[model samples]
Target chain A: MALLNKDGSRLDGRGVTDLRPLKITAGVLNRAAGSCLIEWGRNKVLAAVYGPHEVFPKHLTNPRRALINARYIMAPFSSQEEHGRSGPNRRSIEISKVARHVFENVVFTERFPKTMIDVHMEVLQSDGGTRVSAITAASVALADAGIPMRDLVCGVSVGRVDGKLVVDLDKYEDNLGESDVPVVISPRTKELLLFQLDGLLSKKEVSEGLDMIFEAANVIREKQVQALADKFKDVDSGDLQ
Target chain B: MILEEIKEDYIKELLKQKKRIDGRALDAYREIKITKDFIQNAEGSAIAEVGGTKVLAGVKFDIMTPFADRPDEGVVMFGSEFSPIAHPDFNAGPPDENSIELARVVDRGIRSAESIDVKSLFLEEGKVLGVFVDLYILDHSGNLIDTAGLAAMSALKNTKIPKVEDGKIIRNEFTGKLKLVREVAVTTFEKIDGVIIADANSEEEVASEGRMSLSTSSDGFVCSAQKSGKAGFSKQELMDLIDLSSEKSKELLRHI
Candidate 1:
């Protein structure tokens, strides 16, 4: 298959379980309490954390717990094919749900009673696994905002394509793949925050994919910590603001 | 942009000193801020901020059959939208003439300059073209034409085409720049105190008799010009405005 090279490998020259090169930027938003931009392969997203402040649109307010509102928007011209309309589509809605689930695990909602925290993630580009990348990046952004959290949440996506297992599928691979499993894990407690899959996978393959994802998530979690420490190192707390 | 009567009066008072509400000269535009390669999914994308006005433009190049009439050249289509989220008065649904005019100004600016090599868009003779320009307005403060043009040109300037080899496409993470032959300039005119002022805001637009827009290049070539309102300008007035626009066009090019 053209998807595989002469050596029976993916075209990008990676082992089926390996990830593409990763680049990240923290504290990208000037106005947000916390923000980050993560580029995983070609999938790009900007995530911003807005509160621990007042909650607007009164009725949706939670009296005892802080509300978490997350919106994921794909720009109108993000794809080669015309998207026709801009704003939330079905895919975006699903991503939003998955993102909220991931953050809810790490964020300590009880600390801020009756308040709300808003997380907005904008997908500037999509290669594949945008939801997993957004969840991972937004967790770091929330921490960057200095919001109280239990443990860092790290998300990774794994998939089986063309009779082989792969992690962090790029756009082309994702488009032609048979199955994808995205999982968000809390590294410290080993808890599941978000779990989702598209396409079909046998029970054995699903379990294997889950194990691979959690292992990857642990490694990614450390990187998120290092990214923050590197930024805040030798700087005063006021500089963080 | 809702303003109290006093605020409107305050704006007029500032205009007496040729000042703007945002502390700029009447003829001066607000600061221009640009972000290129801002969108990852889009082939070419940029966001340009002109003071409070913000526009995001993305260019997506697709391989498709060439038009019957323009078999050798690539097709260029400009899509513009002013959302209600940007300004309170802008309504949703099909665009109005005002929005259409904004798209045309940007279209003319890019087309007249031959910014995109139309021939580059062709894959086979009379088959498969490679470029499309999509422009969107995210925020509207004032000066939509200039802001839109800035966004479109910058978006085009920043765009890169994906390489196709052996009928297999490889999506590269980085982008290459577009081919721009020359830069075009756009200037909006408002008649204030029987004199034409450049780059009017919504407030001045409401109070003025009529407005005209002039777009030109560095070499004093007119690319596009449009007039609005029932009031007409004298021949001499047109010449003076053209002279004013010519100088202002060069200045506008600097911001791009």
Candidate 2:
């Protein structure tokens, strides 16, 4: 079946450039230094930050700067699969590595030397675009922890479905889509923090997809800021700056 | 010289002068040597050496029931083990993030390019043949991803699909060469001192602030890409790197 309606609307009645409904809340975990819960469409991801504390095994520590440790975990019942296993399996491991890399670029690790800061993202439910949702929530969790950062990072997946480019694909489109390109950016600086391509796409198509991601990221960035502001409403807004 | 110059600083200084620690040009790769049939017991095998790094890839086949979701499709799995013998940093344990990432990157390149005709391996409604590319890092000087990728691709090129008789295995007998659609190779660049250097060695890898690896297929398109380390690239910089990778991968595929 064609993914689009005769009226140029997506299967979900969204325009090509429209994003899924998103909601983000900070300080969702009391035990952790900071935490965030993000619900985007049918996905729910929670990100937590702990430490800037002593290192384990000792050797992994860097004397000049802190080590950024990030991991992504998917609960066994988190997905639509036939009871997906609680996995840090090869796929999750690879995603965790890239998630850690993006955070490493934005965190001010120099401010806390000889320490390790752990950022963990747990996926409660995943429909599609879990990686982007995880990292987006992780950014808010870091801010809630009072960690200094260059900017709030945002990410979105752009897809070519039914030979038409679209923003923020749902699980249905993701499976039948011709291409999936996930691009992440540090919204303040416009630096690409994460880039991955997983379909047969020409350079031009991928290039155009990047532009779509850039525009979609603004919406995510705004929500991240709003969530943080709401979390710290009791204090002066100047304190946030 | 700055008083606080560390090992990374020294390498970056050389990079600023358009010279690497080993005097290679900014965009030049280390010499690559591939040894095919390195393991006779396996269905296919190759050892790829790039500078001081060595990755051995072996291909083996097994018969299994297809996955529940995709019953008609055959499976191609890539596994990488960073043996302690490779480097001091590696330990004897289950696969870590770096090793997992390496295997996945190589797997993506091959799968994205459709290098193998998986459909041909289907035997029955539920039964299928599984191709496994097992990579061992005998030495880890640096740039293990490219070395592993080359080794896997070369091993695939040398593979022969084992003949099946009534859905039973024939180990020593031949069933003709495996049908390969195209070759894929990876090109990696590390940014140091704000300059991108290709095929970095151990010292250069340590000094680098960011790293990007692009996998290009023989049909002239980037099949996969990964950006790592603690830095980001502008869109223009990323595009330029992709162009460079597409060009460099041609030379690599020719060697296979």
| Cand. 2 Cα-lDDT | 0.87
Q: Which stretches of candidate 2 lie over 4 Å from their true place?
A: A6-8, A236-241, B1-6
Clashing pairs in 2: none
- Per-residue CA lDDT of model 2 for B1-256, tens digit only, reads 1222356878887777888788888888888899999898889999999989999999998887888766887889999999999987789999988998899888888888888988888889999999999999999888999999999999999998888888887897778888898788888889886799889988788778888888888777778888888789888888898788888889887777
Model 1, position B153, has a per-residue lDDT of 76
- What's the C-alpha lDDT at position A20 in model 2? 96
Model 1 CA RMSD to the hidden true structure, in angstroms: 21.8
Worst 10 residues of 1 chain A by lDDT: A195-204
**lDDT over C-alpha atoms for residue B108 of model 1:** 62
Could you give candidate 1's per-residue lDDT for residues B157-233 as a string of tens digits? 77777765544345673335567776766677776545466666666666565566666666765555545442344
Q: Chain A TM-score of each model, in the order shown?
A: 0.92, 0.96
Per-residue lDDT value at A240 in model 2? 62
lDDT tens readout by residue for model 1, A52-144: 888888776777778778787788766645663787755566467556656655678778877889999888887787777887788889999
The CAPRI quality class of candidate 1 comes to incorrect
TM-score of chain B of 2: 0.96
Q: Please state the interface RMSD for every predicted structure, separated by commas.
A: 28.6, 1.1
